[model samples]
Target: MNTPLPLNQIGQFDDEADVVILGYGIAGACAALEARGAGGDVLVVERASGGGGASALSSGIFYIGAGTEVQKAAGYDDTPDNMYRSMIASMGPDQAELIRPYCDGNVEHFRWLEAQGIPFERSYYPEKTVFLMTTHGLMWSGNEKVWPFRDAATPAPRGHQVAMEGDTSGAAAMFALLARCDEAGVRASFDSIAQSLIVDGEGRVCGVTVRQFGQERHYRARRGVIVATGGFGRNEQMLARYFPGLPDTAEPMGIPHTDGSGITMAVAAGGDVRGMDGLIATASIYPPPQLVKGIIVNRLGKRFVAEDAYHGRTASFIMEQPDQRAFLIVDSEIFAYPEIIGANHSLVDGYESIEAMESGLELPPGSLADTLAVYNQQAAQGRDPLFEKHTDWLKPLTDGPWAAFDISFNRSTYYYITLGGLRIGPDARVRRADGGVVAGLYAAGACTAHLSPDGKSYASGMSLGPGSFFGRVAGREAMRGSAAS
Candidate 1:
């Protein structure tokens, strides 16, 4: 965590640009492109040897709509109002104001992504799966079809993936973004780490101090400095300070560069942080959507959540358990759907009967049996009285050869990323504790708390969706500030 210094204390700049961006991930690259597109000279400094941060390691899914062209071609009717309602319901009302612009401009955002060479197929995946195994461009990334939220907003498939085979869409998406930056003549410096921001006498951010080639140098930003350095998933110190409830054994799922440097730098400059406790823990239990037909039990063998809920919500519930543990109970009839399984998951134990399986798991007497009896009774009638799981996934688990899959956070079966960072306005300008903007300072991506306000309701693609979209907003606004100046 580098400490920011006052402008008067820093020496003359070694380089200068209209907009200086830190971390050349998808967010930073998008910011650079938009800043350049806004007629501002752009400079991108990446800590890695090349572009692509965790964005390259992601599944490359973007949650966007308002009846995107691809969604329309796929015979899905969507509207901004419906998308807005869904986002409010899915991400929580706390995020409604920040997400309103995103929902309203989603169609244009989709078009912008396509214009940047990001491709999407005119197809839809109609399945209750974790990720799109096919080249389908559209699917439900969140629990849109589930109860409560389903009735609150018209459900639509908003998970738009890049049209490419295999899981390389993340890398492919980063490559396309970098290409756009190149075409825009954005100067990129790899292996350059931004340490801290430089602020002018008026308290406006004016430049950045970076370490490159074993030397610390200062670069002036005529307009502003954008911090897109991702989250603090790998920063143990930040996690302990902000997210004390996170289990010690919980492993971060992103690249090592997500060490919360951007958030730290912003904070050092008096930026207020939000949603610091929000963490995106996930148990991606699909390669076989049929596995969702199973039941999830806590240590007491009690059902905690709807088995078919979004994986993030399930993981969050599991983490809140006594020992941060949970198990997915299945039966011999559980057959893997080849097309739906995104990754292979091994079963922990298998037994010839429910009693035998319960004994093998060492659960209390009748705890497993009674829970199963009620669940099986409701499931047999295509109903879930407890969790209200959809009928499509309501099936009895009475068959022999029962199995359990460990979905515990301590068991290395779950991956996580911190979803909290500096608070920012809709224009992506970093805000201070006094409810005022930090002049000339902006942030986006995982480093800013714009989307995913709560981990319990986290949706897939929410990170990259706001990361990229707000990155564009930050860049454009930075350029506008420069023009106004």
Candidate 2:
């Protein structure tokens, strides 16, 4: 293991607990629940006035499968092997071994969430949209239906949304988790900022130094300390240091407290970090879900990606384009009133025909026309030869009133979050550069690099999926460590 930071010499203990969890988001709440259930006294610290963090800002979708009862009820078949294969193909092979058990036990994990009072309906959201506005329980939140991944794994609607409508489901999920934590007798301190990890003489993390209400306080952890303080999307300096290529003007979709404090603390305690350059960039253009039927083209007016794929995948392809720009081409027939919320869907240019639209976009003579001609021909036959988009989303752009909406990442609608953090093993113990574990340090949630390492592979429910799952793993391990000692 890398050398650990020396113990805090000046600080004296103000309180003590068997397990101390940083941040009261889904991960920290799950960790506290598991640790308390394991008979370890748990103390959860949150920088916010109450519980919810970036997790509550999410859509509350959990990407779980492996023969879940809801999946079976929805007439979808899934298995651990298939889910594992899909995860590897989508999220990359960063920690495949560590992810194996989670994929295998996904159904059990779903039950675990339900036991925590997180409810899920059996219905599936049929629309191909960014997030569900209805209380549907299942949907295809990733590019599982698109090319390559479809052949890699058996496709299923793995995005299980809470039985709550609109964006408030995330808050609902968190409220359930917080309720479970409270019932388990997990104590929490609000508005407490964890400054650093306190290592013992033997280099085991024993506690944390926190700043609460202008006073420096030390909380001793007899078992372990879990860092779930979330990612560093809000920290512009860290963003510059790690993701220099990312534009400074890009909007971050992180909560204000997602400032990488837990990561810095773990690093000081000899923990390793990974996938620091990874981000969950999104370029959604829906809510008026009809816009999904449009075609996305690059600067050369060539259709690059299947417009029906997950918005994150669309964003990844858009960012990969030259100058990181792309446009969504749609016609007035398919256009509806804009959603007025989330991503912008206003048209930049409108035209009566393909030729006029091409000229308006200023593309080379006949380029846009030729592209649209081929797309319309294939779409008329209910086919997508180039990108193999689903037939339900394929439609000819022959109708008049064609328009183009700029869907580039630089726009106000685009939002992203840092996806890199401390590298931990399957046990959720923080690891060193040499792949050795930091004895008493654990991490979960957006604070650790696990699921959805990058935008290219990101799915809707990946954040909370791994956050809550691994939080339980970390909590159990921490309690086990304390019991052995």
Candidate 3:
């Protein structure tokens, strides 16, 4: 509520701590560990039976830059300023203050994770794929190398993946963080859901109401309460309300319990929200990186975005097309059976001539042909003058047998995540819509909007990046809140 919860009306606290963290995802775990390390009595209330909320499902990569050991071992030169310049356009000016510190402190963050026993390999994946299926440690997880960003800043591979065998390194990372939490003696209540924020007469958060087991319990915090519950991806109502452009066909990614419950609780406590309309919707057309050589045209048969753009960025434009329909036209040389099963890149048809394929797909007679005429002409010369697709992927569609894949969201599928939540300062303190701080309340992870304001702005590991980084920030800051009883 905009108004504060009166202390006299509140019931007796069933438990107490110096700081209480809601949810035990990467951010929550980090917050608990950091607070405990500072000697604050910490309690982590988790909705699941175990830790690692959505972070457990991630590729377990951190969007790190500024000359990490992995980057050095990969023989790439990077600097914090270069990384900052690369991210400014995406993060926008308001969040620009965030990039500098994150870039400068990135190497230290890597060392921090290393201290947690989460190993990181020094190998580099120099391919243009999404997540490495192999154990390679570094890859391009964002738009640093693409147009717009590249013009602003020199590119470097910043995606530092945890040393795990496969793409699902999130489990490995969370397991390690959870162990660190245990070692630090952070009290974690599993299967406990945070129902609401407990505030004092002046609207300062001091505890939380939790539903654990079969009972409703109150856990008081002498210093502060931090909400680290992940995003609202599982919440249908919130999605429909905030992201009106997101089609229902787009599947929500994350745990089933990522239902905006914590966000709603914080909002009810008067926490302001940001990026409510920001979304990360992706129809992955990579993995078969050869397919990126193709061109994606909308319903009117015009190339929308650069073929070499991040798949999520490409998909954002695709979903905005007429009827959310688009086609990926690839020559036989580049065609591969789509690796991502959920993207549903079904074949529309193959054609010997561009005219026949255009007519068959019901496009305006000359639409597809005209689009390809320019694409093929530029591509043959190792150039994409229009979209600036990297020269490395520049290949003419001169192959006889050409095909089109119907990668339309109206017909196929897209993996989506909500990127909007409680608005917070750089310190992870919840700020009201009127710009006043929600006293003693801090939040991190998906529940609090930071980086990744939209699909075009998203990077692969950005979700966990903000989650883990700010989780510690929230922890460190919460320890400074008024320790009044």
Candidate 4:
């Protein structure tokens, strides 16, 4: 057996409890509340002063299958089989199953959210209409449904969006959940960093070592620890180790501190890791302000995707260009829409706005004549003659004073780094390399990989949906284990 590292001493310490939840983000907070519900003592640790992980930076959309009472009452018919098939198709081979549970229990989970006083908005779209009727039958044609995945799924007319105070909507809801935890008397500590896991002679984990407020300390989990510290989107070492070759610029997406501490710690405790090769990448054009301005060039210098592809990765299909540093070409049209430049849709919005605000850069201010002139020039020559736009549709900068932002394709501004974390089975229990359960450990949220057989997100609402669903399940299970002991 390998010798375990000695526990490093730190400042003041507290007695370990039945559960030690790492990371105070959405999943961590949600799980802590659920544990409290089950009468288990819980303490949460977070490195950031403020709570909420990438959850705070989301548009908060979710995917629900059709054919349920909601769809049936609206004359829609969606089936679980169809939804599963579509997810499998979109995610490709082995990557799709990780998300299967969300589809199976989507309706119940949504109802559970309502019970928690959370509200959802319906989003209606045309393709969703077509797919709903053909796949689920007579359902509302409201959602952008992947018909191949489910027999019936029309996006809810108002079920797609959630709003919080100011633009801090996600943060507000998350804080509300944190408030619920406080009412339940769940213990929480901020500015704490989990450095390693405590394992016994037989290799089962007992607790963790954390550093907080410039001090290191130990917290034991009489029941078990939940590693909800999130993924390593900003950790270059983990990124290079798993994804290999992802541009260093990908760092602009999520919190810089979420460097997959949970994932690494779990690996140290004998938990098996899976799906390190898979990544959920988002494409962006605008570099954070102050960095060199990037130029979006197709085979030729020009524009391709709609400046508003902020809607989805559909831009990946539209730009049909090779991955050669092809960024986004923008002009006055882009500037007119305030949402395009900030953290409104893609994750890039936050960092982009920070740079623009700090630098006081006017960003070429709006001028239609100058924008079209450049576009028209490129259109006439038909070769990205000046801007290198080769897709054929993006040419003719007959518009004027255009500008370019270089970005990668198949990427988006805001992305959920879902490729890390402990490998768990369908039951959400952490699994050992020998295929055994890791005693009482569990995981949920983006920190854990979704293992979608399809290469894509499969469905929307995945990040929040799974986090909420599995967090509840895992929390309850942990409590039950604690009580049994």
Candidate 5:
């Protein structure tokens, strides 16, 4: 094993940082904050002009499996074991052991978030039961929807929004954290890209080679480098190479910066990757019907799952299909009930205006009848070829003005960040194929394959829970160890 070299011993030590965090999004900012709180000097770098990777672009629903107090009150006998089993059953057991500890600590992390002045609310339906303990929604600018789940098994109204109605959680979370960081005196620069890991002769990461505004610069870490850089969902080359069936043509409705920078950095350093081919593909209306409500159909113009299904089941059903595309089938009732625009009358129309700027792919700008005609033709045959949909949901397009978008690859409107990336152990450290830690580094948040090795969410809202739990743990652990000398 090689020892990690100090930045001074290598090419040059730009600045001595106790913890150098790449990517200024939630995970990156959280890691920096924790490290700084633990007495480590920190530096944050972002490739974008502002922070908001996927976190900024999200629906802002914090995924928590079970609320702490609620689970205790319910007679369901919830435990970390229960949460782990649920997650494994929902996603896959491949990464279960790694994620269990984090799930166990989820509520504590949320409390941490609350302590940081990030306001959250209990389940809107307080009397009901949910999958996790309690449902909490974030109260930030622009979020207007009430929580969606019921107080049953998974509980309703646990999802939180940044008070900003529609899809503003991404920016809200970023700005909130940015303000906190600025108050904490952590240094950060936007539009700075991390080119590669700065490893020394001993093979441990000492820092990074970064480029900003046509200038190359090196930043050194005295303790460690944390790669909170987002995933590769937008990189067609990487997606095609990893995700076998996913189409790359659909534009990402979320952040534009998630080009798998962290995955690349880790893989280049001999880290192993997994769970890329699987996706938590969502069923959404492409350029969603403006004046009409709709159901997701394949090229055949048929409904697959319930048109009003929640996130997990919706994505799971879509992934089960062969073609991976869904259509928005509408009826006269849909047109009349424009109020159907909201999912459960809570979510505002976030995709309402994208059609004008993103024509050919979005709705309103595209033809509903023409799109449906082509799909209806394909459904008539024994096979649905356009998107290769093999599900039994196929039916004739009897509805008038029915529209369809070829949401294959990249055409779908509501694409969530799949939790699949560099596989890590329970300690939140990246592992080589040989099952040993790749020293001088750590990771957190949705970037790693730690959550959904099976390529799906264990349950709805589990993503944020794990992000906070593991992010806090990894941050603390990384600060505890000395850099390999």
Candidate 6:
């Protein structure tokens, strides 16, 4: 457990800085950049040598909106209010307070990233995709064009991918940011592990105890300590304790060492944790987004959610089905082997008739046939009366020999990222159980829970967007405090 060290036990500090940041991922780097840019001495301690958490492993697409230069170049109109509405609709209206500021500060953050030498191509990937390629700049990374979200706000491609090829955008962005951090003169202590916060007699966090190269060293953070050590996806005990009922089929994804030590430290500092049961559970179901034209049915062979919903949303719904069972039924035309995963692993079987498909999958006879009859009927007229999938993706399944991919929550290999951590306000200050601040403690990124409360609400760039933007906010706020008296 990462516990706070009482000042009474600390005789002296071995080192000190105006701000000490744990975790040199994107959030920590951005925090250091801001704090240093504000004329504060910043020291960053990272668990990894190169210092890119789950972010470095991602595709580097950010959910930036309100008409970023990329969006404008792509010729799409966006507004802060619309972006706010769209996010609140998917992320829950209660999250408005947490995410509204990020939406409002979109353009400002984009400019800041640009100022830091990060480049975003002024282009657009017109298709709905799971990941953008090198030339792709903007795409629909969420349910912006899907059923409920479409009616919530005019659809726009908000995923601003870094100007690079392949799935290494996170690496590219991190390299650029780390370079910027160096230019700002931020001191780095890489391959270091923070064991605890150093709290003074007044119960204020004054420093941290970090172990580097087998030596325990105490470093003072005169202003504040920012925790960005990521989530508990890799901490099975935390996952079982905080959010049980996750099927055994789910595997931990994201940073391998993202074990929630920072959250544990924050809890010891009186930080209240919320949304512990929510997480980003995903089963890669797209490369050909047209798969939405298919139907997802429960064990009873009836569609439960709009197939056009975001893959995460659909996955969430599927997990709620009977026996955590569901399948993606696609006619030959729309089925493309699910480009990324679960092709042979989840392919149940193919059948020439709906009745055979049901029997082969062990569902009640005529169930799938009956369900498809209605779906095909409504789809012919280009409408979904039940789920309200967009007309663009509404097409009757007529192409021969249908195939069903086993997207059942229990049968399919589900990958999840932890979404629960220390609860913080828009200011990025760690909040106590009583809704009071944990003095001298600030956090952003996966170590703190704010945006994307659950799998259903997750958008591709939600993590990077809030992590970097609010990270700067956390940095600026941490420096506002006078050195611990």
User: Which residue ranges in model 1 land beyond 4 Å of their true spot?
Assistant: 245-249, 335-346, 483-485
Model 6 ranges off by over 4 Å: 342-345
96-117, model 1: which lDDT tens digit per residue?
A: 7678898888899889988999
**Tens-digit per-residue lDDT, 1-485, candidate 6:** 46789988988888899999999888898999999989999999887887778888888988899988888888899999999888988888755777788889998998898788878888788876778766577888888987788899988888889888888788888888999999889998888899999998888999999998999999999999999888888887897787677877788877677888999988998888888777777775776777878888888998999887777787788878999988889998887777766422378888898888998888888998999999999999988989899888898998979999888888888777777778888888999999899999999988888587887878888888889997899899999977886
- Cα lDDT of model 2 by residue, 400-478, tens digit: 7888877765553667888899998889999999988988989999989857777778888888998999999999999
Which pairs of residues have clashing backbones in candidate 2? Answer: none
TM-score per model over all chains: 0.95, 0.95, 0.97, 0.68, 0.71, 0.97
- Pitting candidate 1 against candidate 6, the one with the higher TM-score is 6
* Worst lDDT 10-window in candidate 2: 1-10
Higher-TM-score candidate of 4 and 6:
6
Instruction: Estimate the overall C-alpha local distance difference test score of candidate 1.
Output: 0.83
Instruction: Return the number of clashes found in candidate 1.
Output: 1
lDDT of each: 0.83, 0.84, 0.85, 0.54, 0.56, 0.85
In angstroms, the error of model 5 at 35 is 0.7
Query: Looking at model 3, which ten-residue stretch has the lowest summed lDDT?
Result: 1-10
| Candidate 4 lDDT score at position 46 | 80
Model 3, position 280, has a per-residue lDDT of: 81
TM-score result, candidate 2: 0.95
Q: Write the per-residue lDDT of candidate 5 for residues 1-485, one digit (tens) a residue.
A: 12223445556656667788888767787887788789887888789887667677665556553345433433233455545544555455677676666667766766677666665544242221112222234211100111122111232233443344454454556667777878887888678888788776666777877778998778877777777876677877877776665554333435777788777887787677777765554433312223212445444434555433334455566655656644444433333322223222222222222232124333344344455456556656634454334323344454443233333333444354555777767766777878887777777776776465432343434455566556666667778869555
